[model samples]
Structure formats: structure tokens, C-alpha cells
Target: MRSPFDLSFRLKIPLWGSLLIVVTTLAISTSMMVQAYNDVRSDLVSSASSLGGTLAQTLFPAMLHDDVWQATEIIRASLHGGRESNVLRPELVFVLDREQKVFISSQPQTLPLLADIRQRGEEYRRLVDWIATDAGLETRSLELAKFHRIYVATPIVDTGAYLGTLVTVHSKEALLARFYSVAWRGLGIGLVVLAILLPINWFWGRRTAVPMVQLTNSIVDMAQGRASHLLPQNYTHRDELGRLFEAYELMVEFLQDRARLEQGMIRAERLAAIGRLSAGIAHEINNPLGGMLVALNNFRRRNGQDERALATVSMIERGLHQIHEIVNAMLVEAKGKARDFAPQDVEDIHQLLAAETRKCQVTLQIDSNIERPVPLRATLVRQILMNLTLNAIQASDRSGEVRCTIHIAGDQLLLHTENGGKTIPPEVVDHLFEPFVGNRESGHGLGLWIVYQIVTQQKGQISAESRGGVTQFTVNLPLGDPA
Candidate 1:
């Protein structure tokens, strides 16, 4: 069972619109039917009264001449003649004598009742009672035993003496028929008008619904951080929907910006972690890196060209030893084991990088352009340069040259290294400065990470570029007091 007040559209708009149309039309139709019925009934009553008046007028002279019986015959003839020629087909009419006896009538059976009732004084008394009654007019409608009739009565007066009454009865069927026919015609026209308007209502309903659907979908997409297009100008009607569309667009832009900011923060956290890990290894590796550099410098200064050629026989062995030591220290540091930091000769960093690249056999030309000493933990710097040079060497083909240019500019020391490597892949270039972030087979990727840590802690800068067939890493550090 449906509730009386469900109030849903399926039950309301179409149903109710149709119902209202029907009900209003029916109400108007009913009113018209009633008015038509009344007008037709009134017309019948007026015709009856006019006929009665005319008959009374015609009978008045006969009554005045003491020819009441002759007046009675004339009444009968007129009643039969009027009834036979009438368009409305009146039911009956009768003329009563001064004593209230029905002397003549269109229907003969009605006369006996009129005369018998008067002889017993019932008809005469009723007639006198009606004439003296408060009702000044004697016109009424009656429904009697399957017949509906209008009654019009008038008194026949001659020389101020009441002679009799003239009464006529008209059937109500014709008037009722006219009322129903008018009602039917009115109903048909109302339906035609409703039919013309329904389609227009449906079209407007759809137009409103479609834009709301689009706006809802767009809002859902924006909520999920998915890209969504704006509503069409016309669709975003200059009303509440338009304001909602504009607000949604602004929300999307704000969320996109916020998402970018959050992503950048996460990346910064990761890079900072990498730097901390690199700083850990730089501590342990600095001492061994310093020892190795001192050894290399001592050997280079004492050994002549021929002796160096002899040592070159064991070059691969020497290079492997130096790389093995630095790598062990790097691995330990990357694991976050606590270690040390100390002042050391900067040449150690340069020498360690050269030693590691022997595996790649790239010609490394290192030229130091310095005015004062650069203060940094030598082992850490060595690990930094070794990782950078090794990556560059791997990028270069065999026999490719790697150049290291060390110089001072203003109050800073710089290490600029370039290798004959192909241009960096754009996909990886964006993450190049990130830790664990390089294209190398033996790459733990802590190389640039350590470099970044040392440079950051010392308040310096570092950058890499792989363009024009050259992969270059540049390191900048503040020059310290040389005592």
C-alpha cells in the first residue's frame, strides 16, 4: 500500500499535473452543466408561464361574459393544440373552473382527480391555500415517479374575480441532455490543451537534469584527485549550478597545488635521508683515504719515469687495492655505523678517484688550480669524487678521457669532472641528484649522496649535467685558512 503522503515525483508531477487538469476541467464542466441545466429548465418554465398567461388572457373575456363553460372548451382546444405543435413536447396543461374543478386538460385522467378533490373540498382548499401562500410566483420543478418536470401556474382573473388556474408541466430530459453534451465538449478541449503543454514540461525537466548530472560527475572526479574538465558555459547556467561549477574548479586547482607540495616534501625527506647515510660512511672512510693518498704522493715523488713504468706493471693490482679499501669503508658507512671526520690533504680525494678509474682505463687528467688549501675530510671527499668519476668512467667507452679540473673561484674551491659519456637519459636525469640514483652495474648509488652530504654540511653546492655527450659533476666548497 502506498502512503498518502509519499510525495515523490513519479507520483506527483505527471500524475498530479494530469489530475489537476482533469479535476479543474471537470469542475468547470460541472459548473457549466449546472448553469446549462438551470438555463434550459428556466427557459422551459418561462415558456410554460407565457403559454399559461396567454391562455388565461384568452379565457378572461369568456369568463367575464359569464361563458365559463365556453372558456373551458377553448382551454382544452388550446392545450391540445399547443401540446401537439410544441418543440419542447410539454407533458401536460389544465384549466380549472372558479370552483377549483378541472374542466379541461391535455391529459384526460388528470381531470377526474381535480374534480373529485374539489368536490371533497381538498382541491379548492389547496388552490386557495396556494394563492394565499407567501410565494408570489408559482413556478417550480418536480421529479415524480421516473419523470422530471417543470410546473408553471398562474391564476385566471376576470374583473378582479379569480376564475381558475392555468398550469403547464415541461419535461427536464431535454435540458439535462444539453448540459451533458456541453460538458463532454469542454472536457475534450481541456485534454487537447493539456496534451500540447506536457511535452514542453518534459523538455524543460530534461534540460535541468542533464547539467546537474555533469556537475555531480565532475565533483566526484575532483574529490578523487582525478582531472576533470569544466562544465560547458551554457550548461553551467547563471544560477546555483554556475556557482557550484566555479567553486569546484577552484577546489581542483587548490588540491592539485597541495598535492604537488606534499610530493615535493616527501622527495626532500628521502634526499635528506640519503645525505645522512652518506655522511655516516664519509666518517669511517676519511682516515684510510688519507693514508692511501699519502702513500700515492710518496711513491710519485720518489719513483722516476722508468721506475714508474716498472710500477705500471703492477698498476691494475695497485688500483684494485685502493678501490677495495674505499668501497669497504663506503659499504660500512652506508649501513649507518658511526665513524670519524678529520682534516686531510685534498690531493687524496683526487688520487683515490684516479685509482678507481683504472678499471675503466679512462685517461684522467687532474689539474689543481688552488691558491689556499680546501678544508674537508679527505676520505669523504675521495669517496665523493670516486663515485662521481667511476660513474663517468662507466658511461664512457674504453680509452675515453675523463678530465678533472680543480680550481678556486672567490672564496670557494671547485672540483669539475667531465667524462666522454653519452647524454643522460631524460627519464633518469630528474632523479640524478637523488641517492641510490644512477645507472651503474655496481651502483649502490651512495656516490652522489655522500658528495651532497659533505657539501651541504660545509654549506657548499654540487650539481651534475650530462649534456653534449659529456657527463659532468661539479663540486664547490669554501676555502679555509691555510696555516
Candidate 2:
């Protein structure tokens, strides 16, 4: 069984609203109907008593003269006088003597028996005795055997002597009919009001419920990783729902940004570990490379006369030279050589990245506009250029151009590298120089970090930007006197 509390918010609002309306309407209607019934009853009793008193007064002379026929005539005329009056009609009339004997009556056979009255116990007996006393005008109402009636009795006084009691009996049927009519009208009115309010309640509930439902679904989508780039912008109202949409949008953006930062942090950590490993490997390789170079040099010198041997030696030497350059580039801090940066040095760095450029099927362009060599750390400069060029080559589309421009601007050497590819996203650009912040899957995220560190150490600045499908990195290094 589904719990009652499991209802949707939309349904719950209308359900509870309707329930409240119905309950309140019923309470008010019941109260009003009961009050109307009481008012009618009171008025009926008052009218009966008034009529009974009038009859008693009219029959006083007849009673004083001991004319029973004249008293009976007065009672009969009064009972039949108002055929169209709104007053309660009498069903029975009784003229009781002081001894509780029925002297005259409209329906003599229907007169209540003392045995029957006493059978109802003390309350009924007291009521009957009080009316028989004929002290003054008194009234009593009773319902017995489906017959409801109000009895009014007034004492007939003749020369300060009690002649008899002039009693009138009024039926409650007409009063009951009026009571039912008013009750039904109240019920109908309450029903009409509830009918009117139910739709309005449903409509209002729907308005609130639709947005809530959408928000719930959106939250679920977010949890399941199916959320869109931004939250839906359909809500235009300046209510709480609109504010909630705004808050959700902000939350999504924040979470996405946080995820990117975490990924970058993880990549940076991985690269740091790789860099440590590479440095150790490079240090170990250096000793072996030195011994191989020496052995090859000796072979080349001894095999100078043999053309085939010399050719082979040259190839071996070239391979060793390339390997030595790579290991030295990897161990830049180990070399720690600072010297003037000449055009040839830039050419050498370009040569170092040539294999990578070809592997990526990208064309590399080099431009130098410096008048003379600039004083800089040769090893660090070579490392920076090699890393930047390799990154540009990898970032470029197949057969796209990677442009490298080096020039002297006032007291600074400006180096700019541009690659043709998709524009870098703003989030990546913001942390471009941070370790392990590359957008590429295969990137170690260390090249730019190393470049940034080297440039900052040399009192230079580096900045990256991407626009119109091209990404560029610019480095500004302070020029020093050539040594």
C-alpha cells in the first residue's frame, strides 16, 4: 500500500487545500443550519404561545359565564382563522379544567393520557403538571411516536378565580420543513463555493509543481552525469523558482571548474613524478654516452682510410650526437651553462624538435630578427625553445604550420610561438603555465611549467592566448650584455 505521504507536491497542495475547504465549509454550513433550526423552533414556540394567550383572553368571558359552547366557538374560530398565515398551525387544542380534566378539545381522541405521560418518567410528568397548574402561560415541546408538537397553556382567570386552562397544540412539521429547506440551501451554496475554489487551487498547484518537477529532474540528471552545459533558462518569473534556477546554474559552473582544477592537479602530480624519473635516467645515461662518444671518436680516427668504415662511423657519430643533445636537454639543470644566445643556438633548438614536427606532420617556421647575440643561459634557452616547439608541433593539426618568431624589442628579447589548431578554452588558458594543465591527452603537462619556471628565474614573463583557432605563447626575456 502506498503511504498517503508519498503524494507529489503538486497533488498534495490541491488535496490538502480541497480537504481544508470542504471541512471548513461543512463546519460553517452545519453551524448555520443548526442555528436556523433553533431560530425557527424559537419563533414557532413564541407564535404558538402568543396565539394560545390570545385565545385564552377571548374565551375569558365565555368561561366566566360558564358557557362551554361559547368557549368552544372561540377556540374553533381562532384555530381556523389563518389559513394562509406564516404562523405555525395548530394540530390539536385542549381546554383543560383546573383538575386536569379535558373540558373541550380540537381532537379529543388524540389527547395525551396521564399514564402515557408518566411512562416517560419524571421529566414528562413535571412538564405536564406545570401546564395543568395553569399559573400563567407556559409551553412544552415533545416528540412521541413520530409526532412532534409544542403545547401552550394559559390560565383562564374570571374575577380573580381560575376558571380553567386554555391549551393550544402546534405541530412541528411545518417548522421542520422550513429548517430542511434552509439546510439544503446552505449545503448547495457550500458545494458551489468548493467547486469554484477547487480548480483555482489545482491551477495554482500546477504552476508551483511544474517548476519543482523540472528542478528535481535537473538535479537527477546532474547526479547521473547527463546534465547539459548550462541549466534551462525557461523560468522567467521573479519568484523563488527563478532564484533557484540561478543558484543551480552557479552551482553547475562552480562544480565544473572544480573538476577541471582537480584533473589539472592530478596531471601535474603525474608529470612531477615523470620529471623526477627522467632526471635520474638522464643522469645515468650521461656516463654511458660519454664513453660511447670517446670509443666512436677513436674508431673514426683509426678507420679514416677505409671509406665504408668512415661512412658508418659518421652515421654512428650523428646518432650519438643526437642522443647526447636529447640527454643534455633533459638534464639542463645538470649542465647549468649560461651563455650568449646566438642565431645558431635557435637553429640548433629547431633542429632538436624537427623529428617531432615531422612525426606530427606539421611544418615549422623559424624567424630571427636580432642584430647580435643576446646574453642568456644557452642550456635553459635551448630547453625552453625545444619544449615550446615540440608542444606547438603536437598542438597543431596535421600539415598545419607552427611559427616561431624571435626578435629584439628595446631591452628585451621577444620569443613568440603560434600553432594552428582549435582555440584553447579560457579555463585552460588561465592556468596555462601551471604544472600538468595541458589540454592534450598525451601531454605530460611539464613542458610549459618548466618553461615558465626558467623564464621567471631569468626575470622574464610568459603569457599564452588563443583566438580565432590559433594558440600562441609569448615570452619576454631581458637582454643582457653578450659575453
Candidate 3:
């Protein structure tokens, strides 16, 4: 979470990287620049010395040998070649005798640099000491009027005998001015290159940081129950970041699946607890309810009643029978057995119940839209449909209508049913699908419980809704077509 401008070693990437590149580049550049300067200066001095030796060799000995015309011609030629050699060439050249008197000079239009070798005493004395005492040629700067020159001198010797000295002068201003221009130009180019690299460094740093940012955000979102989008796919890179992103995506998927499994586990635990409670309640009431049904049936059979008497007896018997039926339903749900799987036709089965619903003065609507060869366990599906429809009929007071609708969409088969019943309370909504927990005075809420188990074991979904004074339940099953 460090800001980009912090520029600390640990906080900023581009700053450190760019600083290192620049520092290293400048260090190398400075070393090379100094070396280059020394080299250029050395070459300049060497070239000047070579030109002076050539001029002196051609002129001095021959002049002493009384060849004045040849010496003069050689001096003119040396000066011309020196001028063409570099932009800043020698300004003056002169020879001095053993007494430091100018013996011969080039460009004599000016007064002798040492007017009287003895009268212009001190300056010449120091100059002589530097040239004679120094092991190599000597260079010193001089200013006369407005022009500046670098004075260079070398001992002139003939056959191991000391003759005098040879001197050459070069313009200081011009050499320095040109060097400054070139140096500045090189510095400007280096700075421009450094500037261009800045954006590139910024871009690379941000690209590297973005994935980490996204991963952090994803982790936060996943901590809540929200689904997160997958990270951007980047398979080309085989680095650790790519591996981390891949691992993170896998972990998220694993967590979501584990969460669903945990929810199912919790629901199962709730059902088990309810089943235990319902089984105890049903066991307590079942025998008495069964006895009541038996006595009512026995009395009716023995009496040989007329129609009015038989109808009253039949009503009482049927009412007692329903109590026994409810107790049995509770026991069945509490046992919680796993259902076997097979194929079944829902419409054909609905036809069997059509007669009973008609006799009860009730309407039955069955949808056969999913009659296409569906893979389902015949017994389980029949039990689930029958339990749910019967619950609907009973909730509707055995007189109100019960409607069943079935359809198949894509890879899922859906069955929805609604009956004329009161809207379920908010508090009861959560427990509606639980075993032994329904809304009948004699009811153990096992009907939906069994329905839930059958549909869920088939990898299907079931949900109930109560709205506008009517209750509806929808079951969804994945279309199992072979594999």
C-alpha cells in the first residue's frame, strides 16, 4: 500500500531501477569522458611535437650549413601543413640560441617574443628553467594584447650536442570553444535518452503490480458470499505470478464448491434432528389413531346400516383413517431411507389418481410436457409426486383444486404444483421442506421431507413459495440422458 512517490528502497520500483541505471550510466560516461579528454590533449601535443621536429630538422641544420634559401622554403612549407592539420593550429614558431636570443622566427611581423633575451630577463629565465629542467617538452599559457596561446617548447639538439630550443604556439581559445560545444551536445543527448526511458519504466512497474492488486481485491470479495470473476488469463508467461493467479483461481472454485457442500450438510443435520423429534411424536400417537380407525370400520361392517347411517359411519371412519395415515407418514420420513433410481412416466401415474380426486369432488390438473424418455427412479418419483399432491389436497381441505405442471427446459426437467391453501408464514417458510414439520393438527411434516430427499438425491433442486393466499412448490431435476 505504499504510494509511488515515496521513493524509498522498499516503496518504489521505478525510482530505484531508474536511479541505478542513471547512476551507472553517468559513472561510466564520466570515466570515459575524462579518458577521452586526456587522449585528445595528448594526441594534439604529440602531433604538434611531430610537426615541430619536421620543421626544425629540415631548416635548422641546413641554415647552419649556409642554406638560407632552402631553410626559408622548408619553414614556409611546415607552417602551411600545420595550419591545414587542425582548426586550431600553431600561431608562432621561433628558435632560441644558447643565450635565449631569438635566432630565427616565423611571423616576424610582430616584435620578438623575448625582445632582449637578457633585458626581458626574468620571464625568459623561468621559461628557460622549465624547458631545460623538465624531462619532457613544456607547455604554458601566455596572453599578449587580446589573443591567448599555449606555448610549447622542446630542446633542439644536434648529434648529442645541445644546440638551443624549438618553440611552437597554439591558439587556446579555439580548442576550448570547440571542445565545450561537443561536450554539451553529448550531455544533451544523454539527458534526452534518460527522459525517454522514464515512461517505459513506469509502464513496466504498473503492469507488474496490477495482478497483485486484483488478487487482493478478489480475496476480499470471496471472504463475503459474493462470486468473483476469474482473473485475466495469461498463459504465455511461466513466471511465479502467473502460477499464483492460477492457484488463486483454483482455490476460489474449491471454496465455492466446499461452501455448497457445507450448506447441504447443515440442512441434513437440521432434518435429522427434526426426524428424531417427529418419530417420537408419531410413535406416541399412532396406536391410538389406528385403534380408532379399526373400531369405526368394525362398527360400520357389523351394523348393516341404511344409506344415512352408513354415510355418517363412513365419514367418521375416514376421518380416523386420515389420522393414522398422517402418523405413518411421519414414521416414514423419520426413517429417512435412500431411494433407488429408475425411469418413470409422470402422466401415466397421474391418470391412476384422477379417479380418486374426481370422487372427492376435486379437480386435478397434470402436465405431461416432460413425458419424453426421462431417466428417473419410478418408485421415488411416484412417491414424491404423490406425497406432494396429497399434501396439497389435504391443505386445500380435500375440496379445493390441485394443479400440477411439468416441463423440460434445456438440460433440466421442472415440475411445479400449486393448490388452494393459505399463504405460509415467514417463520414457517424455512422449515416447510423439513421432515415431520408440516401444518396439520395430525400432520408430521414428512411429505415435503421425503420429496426433498428424492429430488435432491437425483441432483435436482426444489423450492416452495406462498403468495396471494396460495402455496406452490417447484422441483427441478437435471436431465439424465445415459452418461
The candidate that achieves the highest lDDT relative to the unseen native structure: 2
Arranged by TM-score with the best first, the candidates are 2, 3, 1
Candidate 3 segments whose C-alpha is farther than 4 A from its true place: 1-36, 58-88, 91-112, 115-132, 135-152, 169-173, 184-205, 219-227, 231-240, 284-328, 333-345, 348-379, 386-432, 435-447, 453-483
> In terms of lDDT, which candidate is stronger, 1 or 2?
2
Q: Model 1: per-residue lDDT, tens digit, 330-431?
A: 443433332322223345655666665687778877776653435544455566666666677778878999887767677777778888867988667657
For residues 1-483, what per-residue lDDT tens digits would candidate 2 score against the true structure? 877678877788778877888889889999999899889888877787777778877778886676778877887777686665454777767676666566676664655422244344654455567665546544444444244666666777656677777767666777778888898899899989988988888888777787787788888988997654443566778888889888888888887888868865665566456567767897898889899989988877773368887888789889989877766554436254557778788778777888888899999998888555778766777777888888889989999999999888888888899999999998778667665677888866667878876776677877788999999999999976666
Tell me model 3's lDDT, rounded to 2 decimals. 0.67
lDDT score, candidate 1: 0.64
- Overlapping backbone residue pairs in candidate 3 total 5
Residue pairs in steric clash, candidate 2? none
lDDT per residue for candidate 3 within 1-483, as digits (tens), equals: 756685432226666767876887687667767766556556657777777777666655764664545655665565675345473366667767666776666765552643544454554556556665664433333333244455567656656555566777767665666566666776786688778776677666666666666676777787776657664663336698788788877898888889868865777678767767877888888877778777877877785578888898888877777877766765653233433333245655566677768766677877666544555555666777787777776676457788987676778777788888687886687677786568787655577887886676677888778888788988888866542
Q: What are the per-model numbers of colliding residue pairs? A: 2, 0, 5
lDDT against the true structure, each candidate: 0.64, 0.75, 0.67
Residue 225 alpha-carbon offset, candidate 2, angstroms: 7.2
Worst 10 residues of 2 by lDDT: 111-120
User: How does candidate 3 fare on TM-score?
Assistant: 0.59
Model 2, residue 440: distance off in Å is 11
